[model samples]
Target chain A: MDLTLKIWRQASSKVKGQFVNYQVQNISAEASFLEMLDILNESLVAKGEEPVAFDHDCREGICGACSLYINGRPHGPDRGITTCQMHMRNFKHGETIIIEPWRAKPFPVIKDLMVDRSSFDEIIQAGGFVSVRTGGIPDANSIPIPRRNAELAMDAAACIGCGACVAACKNASAMLFVSAKVSQFALLPQGRIEAQERVQRMVAKMDELGFGNCTNTYACEAECPKEISVSNIARMNREFLSAKLISHKEF
Target chain B: MGKSLTYSSITKKIIMSLAGLFLISFLLVHLGINLLILFDNTYESFNTAAHFMATNPLIQTFQWVLFIGFIIHIIYGIIVQLQNWSARPVRYMKKGYSELSFFSKFMIHTGVVVFIFLIIHFANFFIVAKFGHVDEVTYKSGTYENLGAVVVETFKIGWYVAFYVVALLLLGFHLEHGIQSAFQSLGINHWRYTPVIKRIGTLLSILITLGFIAIPLVIYFS
Candidate 1:
């Protein structure tokens, strides 16, 4: 299949960026979206032109490294899949695909179709973990967690720290990502000790990072590659509220 | 703890949610009283209910609380929406499609329309009742401010009734999203119960929209 790509091009973060159109011919329908870009890049490099730059790792889709806003979606039009997993067959031949980087104040564009997502690292560093030191790997049965709680925690734990939620959200809110991280720990016995502190510190950092607030639009959940539930956000809200109103911790 | 409730995004939403819930409850009471107008052409019962609502000491106190609820809902709405707009300084070239509900996506727009309607509503009724004078209606018990007559007069205008119906429908749209959303913000969401809450939200929106619109239409056509 042949395709026309309207790609955003930027030399660096310091300069202005605009959409640059390029045409790729004789592409296979089964090729991954990233591979299609690779074909474009190979031709560009052969002609002594700079190739389009994007983030990709673990092309199987779990690394959360591939970030591309294709045709206005976070990871192309396919549901529950990252850009790397998106195949060319989703589009018709001669279709023009618009590709751009995640546009958020916190996740700034680094170059053509590549963004700086280190702000997520900053939020996770705030308090997204249990502080207690476990001597070694404990027996799986030792935790004595309920089946429901284990299932819910595992669901929340599936978050790969992709900024797609931020990109898809009308407000650019990180609540889904933050809430998933908070729920993954808060639902477990081992992570319960620091639940109060974890929610507070992480929320404070999220607010400080200038991420927008959730308006309950559920767009984040719709566009999530992992299909993470927004219910985790409600859990985080409950945790934050309880911690603020009832916790014995000193202000 | 260091974060202020006014400054924090989550806390601000909590405030907005609580205020919205309070306003929703207030509408229920207002709707019940407005429904009384349908019972009598002379407007005796409705006027008496209105007089009692205006004069009752506890209701008067709660009225102040209602105002605070409105103020909080509006102020925080503006603050959060501005922050949201600034979060995406550059607009997307292609608008994305999602399965997100239509009501959820346009809360700010619906809210602004309701606000404009509120200004007109207040001028027509609240200010007239509080600061201006209305003719008195006499019951066997005593004489009181004829608030029902004021409503009747306002509803009698064809364009005004049309405007009222339009505004109420938009308010209903706001409530459709606002009711379920407020519960989510307050951490009341669960897969087991969220569907139920959404149903109730839709039911309440229909009830309020039709209930409020009924009085004006009945009055206008009667």
Candidate 2:
């Protein structure tokens, strides 16, 4: 199968970019989308053109590195899937695919389709971890966690920091991402020790990074490759309110 | 006040809800007055009621209060938007999908559009009737024919009624998210009661928005 691709080409963060068209022939329907891109790159290299630069590591979708907004939808018109996991079979032969990097303000274009997602790293670094120190290898059964709470924590922990929520958001809000991180920690007993500080620091970092306010638009959840629940956002809100209330009283 | 400022996003949304609900109340009062036009002799009574509302000192005071509320609500909304805009100066570059609802994703867009529509509405209806040239019509009493006649004439223009209905539709879309989220933001969510409250909010939003739309259509066609 052959396909026409209009992929965004940007040399650097400062350079203005636009979609440049390329045609690839003999694409296998069974080939994964990234593999097709690989084929395109090989063709480009042979033709003495710069290979399109896109981010990918664990092509299995766990890394959340491959982010592409194909056509108008993110992750190429698929539900509950990452870009690397999307297959060429989704597109027909001779189809024109419009590929662009995530259009959120926080994730600036580094080159081609790759974007600087380090803002997510900074948000996580702000307070994504529990302050509890590891002394000795503690018994897992020592801490009693409610089954429901454990499950909820695990669900919140499922967020891969893909920034899809930000991309999918019309206002480009990162509340869903920040909330998931906050809720994951807030739900656990170990996380409770630093809950107040964690939420405060992380939320402040999120605000400082310039993510939009969450208006309860679940676009983030919908576009999340991990299928993170919007309920995490609710939980985060509850936690933030409680944290602020408690901290104020003490001060 | 410091704590309130810290939670300004939630506080601002609460202010939006208060203003929105107040506007909803005003709508009910306006609807009651308009319903009187259905009766042949009650037109004068309706005019009397409207005249009193326009001229009464208390009502005038309340009207100023309403204006302030509107300004605060819209200004706060814009502030929130600008804050979000500055926060994410770039779009997301990741390619993936999740399960967010359509209404949730487009709330801001719908809200901004509705805000523009509102400005047009106020300029046409509120500004024109209050300050523009309006003829006095005498029936059972001397009432300015300005308000009702202006509304009727505006609806007579096909584009005016069309814009109004479109604006009402946007309002409906805005309420779809605003009503339920307002409760959530206020921490009113209880396991059993949240669903019930959400349903009521949806129903009220639909009815009020549709009712407002219906008025223009009825006036235009009738």
Candidate 3:
């Protein structure tokens, strides 16, 4: 199939970027979105031109490394899949596809179709962990965990740390991302010890990094590659409120 | 930027929601009191209710508290709006606005219109009752200023009635989004009750809007 591509081009973080048009033809519908891009890059290299730069690790959806905003949605028009998992068949033949990086104040553009999501890392570093003793691994079934609780923890753990929530948010809010991290621990007994401190510190870090506040738009859940529920955000809110109310110390 | 408001965005929202909820209660009381005019055509009950509301010491202090609540609500709203606008400096090239709710997208827009209406409303009624004076007429029991008459005369003008009704409808829009959003912001959100809260919020907003609209309609037509 023939495709028209408008990809964002930027040489460096300090420079301004703009969309550049390119054309690719005779591509297989079975080829993945990244594979289509690979074909485009091969042609660019053959023409002695700089190929479009994007981030992708595992071709599977697990890595959460494929970050691209295709046709206004994160990871293209498809729901519940990252860029690497999207096949070219989703686009009609002769369609013009606009591809760009995630846009948010915290996730600044690194190059073409790539934005630095280290803000997510910083937020996680702030408190997305439990203070467990470093020793031999405890038996997995040692703790009496409810099935509902374990399922919720696993559900919240599905967050890919993708910045789609921020990019999709009007205010660039990181509430969805932060909330997922908070819920992953809050639902589990192992993480209950520092739950209060973890929520407070991580939320503090998220705010300090210039991420916008959540207005409950639910865009994060809509564009999520993992289809992570916004209910995690609700849970996080409950945790934050409880933590703020019970604690005496001020951040 | 006030250090005391708390640095956490959710806390700021929670505080603003407290003010919003306070103001919502004030709306109900005000609505109930004003509703007296619709039933008592002779204006006795309405005027007496107004007199009591004016002279009662408890209600008087609450009026001031209501004013403070309004101040806090308006100021916090502005602060959050400023912060939100500044958070994203560069706009998206192809913004998928459909990704956001209509309520979320135009909160500030409806809020600004409602704020302007509030200023006009105060100038029309509150300022006149406080600083200026309305003519009084002797009733069956005692001599009482006919505040309801004042309302009727004001609504007699077609344009004023139109403006009043439109503004109240805008207030309805603001309240619809605000009431539920406030709950979500305050962390009262849960799967079991959040949808219930949203529906109640919408119903309450519509009722309040119609309640305010009914007064002007009854005044003008009857």
Candidate whose lDDT is highest: 1
Tens digit of lDDT per residue, candidate 3, span A125-200?
A: 9999888678998887899989999998998899988788888888888999999999999999989988999999
Positional deviation of residue B151's Cα in model 3 after best superposition, in angstroms: 1.6
lDDT of 3 by residue, B1-222 (tens): 568455588877777888998899988988998998888878898888888888899999989999988888888787777777777776667776345456777777887888998998899988887778898977877877788888888999999999989988888888888898888777676778988998999999999999999998877787
The 10-residue segment with the lowest total lDDT in model 1 chain B: B1-10
Best by DockQ: 1
| Reference-based lDDT, each prediction | 0.91, 0.77, 0.86
Note the chain A TM-score of all models in turn. 0.97, 0.96, 0.97
Clashes of each: 0, 27, 0
Candidate 2 Cα misplacement greater than 4 A, ranges: A134-142, A249-251, B1-18, B44-65, B83-163, B184-198, B219-222
lDDT of 1: 0.91
Q: For candidate 1, what's the TM-score of chain A, rounded to 2 decimals? A: 0.97
Angstrom error of the Cα, residue B220, model 3: value is: 4.1
lDDT of 2 by residue, B1-222 (tens): 355345545445656667766766776777677666545433576667778888899999998888887776677677777776675564434333445444655566777887888789879877877778877777746645646666667878998888778877877777777778766665465669878977987897788787788877888788
Best by TM-score: 1
TM-score of chain B of 2: 0.84
Better of 1 and 2 by TM-score: 1
Which has the better lDDT: candidate 1, or candidate 2?
1
Q: What CA RMSD would you report for each candidate? A: 1.7, 4.3, 1.9
